[model samples]
Target: MENKVVKVIIGILVVSVVFGTLFFWFTPVKDGKKQLDQIKMNNNYLILLIQVINRVLKLAILTTMKDLKIKLNQLKFQIVLN
Candidate 1:
């Protein structure tokens, strides 16, 4: 039950991050040197944001995997004892 909740939360987070990244990546920039320059600056910030989001995603996946591994090990121990 708890695991299902965690999975749902992670799924939502992943979908949101993917959609947000795609939205930023495909957003149109107005035509002009000044506008282009401004977009380039904003792109840098967006890139940083993307990197942070990717890191968060990686951390969440790793944590979830670790938790599953621990739970599996605990279950194995219980079975052995029983």
Candidate 2:
């Protein structure tokens, strides 16, 4: 039962990530740039924000992958134990 819940959660997370990446990547570039520019006048701050955003994106992807791996491992264990 727990394994099934994990699978469902992982499935939802994967779908969310796919849709999120697509949404963010294909979003109008001009608006993004404009907002980034408005947030900070200094180049350094803009660079920092960009870096943070990139890191966050990477971390999110990594986290989702890790969750999936754990769920798969649990299922494998259950299969072996059965």
Candidate 3:
């Protein structure tokens, strides 16, 4: 049950990361400064939400990868002991 939950969460994060990457790539930028100014002026909540989601997804991926590495190492140790 716990494993299933983890898998689902990871899947959601992966999807969010992909969508965020595509959105960032497709978003128009004008002179860099104008982009920032436009975001500020337009009160772009969607951009802010995307940024937050991307950041959270990145952190979650890093954490999940680290956990998997640790589990793999533990499995190797157990095999060695056996």
Candidate 4:
């Protein structure tokens, strides 16, 4: 009975190892490389979008400042009560 159990256990281990080796050796490698490339492209697109938004905000702030300066120059301050 003990010999039977040992043989069964060894058989199970050998089968498991064979399956594991086949899975690792025969798996497609291109799918992983494609996924990595897609992630990198998405990251580059996001960076470009952020840079555009920053440029637009800078232009708006500068225009607002110019308008404010012009309004300040037009205002008159007098302390005379007559």
lDDT of each: 0.73, 0.63, 0.70, 0.58
Off by over 4 Å in 1: 1-31
Compared with the true structure, what per-residue lDDT tens digits does model 4 show for residues 4-67? 5545555665565567556545555578887676666656655655565566556556666777
Indicate whether candidate 2 or candidate 4 has the larger TM-score: 4
Tell me which residue pairs clash in candidate 2: none
TM-score of 2: 0.43
Error of 3 at 26 (Å): 25
Expressed as tens digits, the lDDT of each residue in 1-82 for candidate 3 is 4456656766786686678657755678878897777566445645666676677667667777888998999999999999
Candidate 4 C-alpha error for residue 35, in Å: 1.2
What lDDT score goes with residue 61 in model 3? 74
lDDT for 81 (candidate 2): 100
lDDT per residue (tens digit) for residues 1-82 in model 1: 5557656766776676677667665677677886677667667866766776676667767777889999899999999999
* Cα displacement (Å) at residue 53, model 1: 0.5
Name the top lDDT candidate. Answer: 1
Cα distance off (Å), candidate 3, residue 35: 19
Which residue pairs of candidate 4 clash? none
Lowest lDDT 10-residue stretch of candidate 4: 73-82
Task: Give the clashing residue pairs of candidate 3, or none.
Answer: none
| Residue 34, model 2, lDDT | 75
